[model samples]
Target: MHLLIITREWPGYVLGGISHHICNLYNEVVDKGHEITVITGTCPQSSHELTGKKPPANEVHTVQFGYRKGYYVLFPIALRNYLQSFDFDPFDACITHTGVPFELPLPTVSKRHDCYEATKEYIRNGLSFLETIGDRLMGPFRTIVDRRSIAAADCLIYNSAVCRAGWESAYNITTPSIVSHNGIDTSVFYPDSGYNKEDYILFVGGSERKGLSHVISFARQTKEDVIIVGPDEVNSPHVDALGRLSSDELRQVYTNAAVTIHPAGWEAFGNVILESVACGTPVVATKNCGAVEVLPSSACVVTSEIERGVMKAKNLNSEDCIKAASKQTWDKPAQDMIDIVRSITNPEC
Candidate 1:
């Protein structure tokens, strides 16, 4: 089957869980004997040519739309024309990884990464009424565009039950939705990485939405050695501030740390939770995180209650944690996605 994947970004081209998800899906789908072509946008500073590790010299081509860097919300005329002019021929199915050109004839699927209803909550953490109003006024335009794109799809794929619930509640469009969780590369995120175990808690920070403040507060109250690695280290004593480690480096952090922490109120699916468990590191995270689906009771202490999490982290069992993480891998979920795409295109099989 010929598949046209329309996404906002690609793996090496963009950074985030969404890109990781797309790369895994693309790799697995192409391996399973299907022609895959990816169409995505680029920043103003980015090279005009699409670049990434090619897969098996197969029939997969990437169509890059814009330059390297610019305002993320607006689309350039060139990008708009390039996207709108995409021919719906020679493809059995089309999947919009993010909002792009709205109209497509083939059996279309749009994966909803995060529901805007809940995302607004995170955005309005401590904003005043006027500030909140300003954000809300600006936010719904994007939401409308997303709604139009997903509403046009034959199927909508969600990463977690929480996100699915939010979509149902927010949009009232519940036609053929499925919860296909994200996958992790077990080979890379495994338990025995041979790194010196650091006697400190590790918190991978993101901006406000990721609840870095929560991690900082928890660390300060407990006075535990906490190393943070991500976009920013927001004022914490034990923070090492690695500031965006490579995938390999992340695995190292997972193996060496005493515990991995994720406190975000709204996460579609927390891949870090799975990475931590795969590295034989127990996670002290909120039950609300999408990783709760894959996380074993023995592997993680799932609660927002601070004392419970701290206590659980202090007494995590390594064998149990490793056992739990063993269930998740890149292969299974990747295959599941392939099956879904196949099912959409070939309903007879």
Candidate 2:
């Protein structure tokens, strides 16, 4: 089967959880004897100096669409024009991995990494009303576009039940959907990485929506040794800032730390939670994070009370955490996606 994948985040081109998800999914789908044609935007990693390792060789054919101007909302219009201008081969199915909605002539699946409704809510809480005035003004336009584009797709794939709930809650409608969680590269993020355990809290992401403020409060309250990578500088005595670490360095921290904290305000699926667990470190996450849904009861303490959760997670069984994380490789979700595509294109098995 020939599949069409449309996304902005491509391997080596963009850095994020979505990029990692799409890159691994593309590889997994290709390995199962399917040809993939990708349409992506230009977001180069070189601009940010993510130069530790070369991106894995992507075997699929890819085409990039250069938008004349900005606005992520313009992707649909640009993609429509790009397809109309070129003569492309018919694909059995098209999977769109984008925040905004997209439409395709072929059988299409909307793969949602995050939902905007809850995202906006979290953003508003983090910022002032004036800061969100622009979003408020553009809300109707975005909602209209989403209604037209996403409602027309044959199927929708959500990264987590939490994400799906948020999407549906905002729209007050339902669609043909499947909850296929993100996968982890167990080979790199595993227990026994030759790192001695240390008594400290670790917070990975540095975004406002990721609850950076919550982590800061936790650090100040507990006065525990906290190694983080978010803020440009650190003034606190308890917190040590490691600007940005390579994949190897990140894994080393995950293994050595007593616990990893993910106090996300509205995460679709917190990959860092699983990554920390895969490396034999327990996690402390809020219910707003989707990754907490699949974690074993023994692996993490799900609570916004970071101080208590972080302290309790330190005693969580490492073997239980690793056992749960080992099952989340990319191939399983890719195969499930293939099944959905085949079902859409060919009604009879």
Candidate 3:
């Protein structure tokens, strides 16, 4: 099958988990002998240097766009016009991630990586008064775009059941959908015996929604070292800010940590938890996040008692940690996606 994938993020220029997810899926699908054409925003040179890997799409069309507020309004318009100008053979099916361009053909599947309403709520709760006001001013436009994108799709794919349910309840959406949890590359994230284990707690993610403040507060309470890795750095004495390590370095950090904590109040799916567990490191994650769907009870804990949760997780068997992560890989989800496309293109089969 020839697939046309439209997304704002891609590997070697990853903005978040969605970037990694799409890249992994692209590789898996291509391995199955399907041709993929990707239309995405220009990837920063720095990101390519950091990841040290080439972009995965068979054909890539990069558009120049800024990270400013109005880019959201402009990008879709530009994308739609660009797609309309294509003079080549028609694609078998279209698969979009996150944002969708307007008026795309049917059999196009829109994969919702996160719940927009839930994210807006997080911004409202986590931002300053001035920032909240700015967000409020932009709320209506964002809502319209989000609704139109979701409404335009022939089928919806969600990264987690929690994300799907929250979106349905918030938007009153009755669209047909499926939940296909995101997966990790076990080969890259697996535990390494050579890296000696450390005594620090690891927290990944730089955003306010990622529970950065919660991590700092937890760090202050604990006597052990706390390492925080992300785009931004914090100045707290309890925190060692390592801004964006490469995947190889991150895997080592995960393998050596005493415990990794994910305090995000909500996540479409927590890839960090899977990465941590795959490295044979136990994790203490918020009970409400998507990680809970795949994690065993022994690894989950409430946000309020993160310290206690860490202690409990430390006692969890390493084999169990790897076993749980092993169940989720790109292969199954990629196959499921192919099935969905087939059902649409060849209904009788």
Question: Whole-model lDDT for model 2 versus the true structure?
Answer: 0.77
Return the TM-score for each candidate structure.
0.87, 0.89, 0.90
Question: Candidate 3: which pairs clash?
Answer: none
> What are the per-residue Cα lDDT tens digits for candidate 3 across 1-349?
9888877766655555566777678789888888888877643431443254433566778665556344455567667767677744658888888566375764788888887688777667767899889888877887788788878887888888888877887786766789888888898999886777788899999876777788889899989799998955696888999898878899999999988999887777888888998998888887657767877865545455788888887787777888888988888889878988988888899
- Runs with alpha carbons beyond 4 Å of true place in candidate 2: 43-71, 99-102, 124-131, 234-237
TM-score of 2: 0.89
The sequence of per-residue lDDT tens digits that candidate 1 reaches over residues 129-205 is 98788677767666667667766788888888978877778776856878888877676688664567677888776
Listed per model in order, the count of residue pairs whose N, CA or C atoms clash below 3 Å is: 8, 0, 0
The 10-residue segment with the lowest total lDDT in model 2: 45-54
Candidate 1 residue pairs in clash (backbone atoms < 3 Å) = 43-67, 43-68, 43-69, 44-68, 44-69, 45-68, 45-69, 46-68
- For model 3, where is the 10-residue window of minimal lDDT? 43-52
lDDT of 3 at 167: 89
Candidate 2 lDDT for residue 165: 90
**Which stretches of candidate 3 lie above 4 Å from their native place?**
12-14, 43-56, 66-68, 124-132, 298-304
Question: Highest TM-score: which candidate?
Answer: 3
Please report the TM-score between candidate 1 and the true structure: 0.87
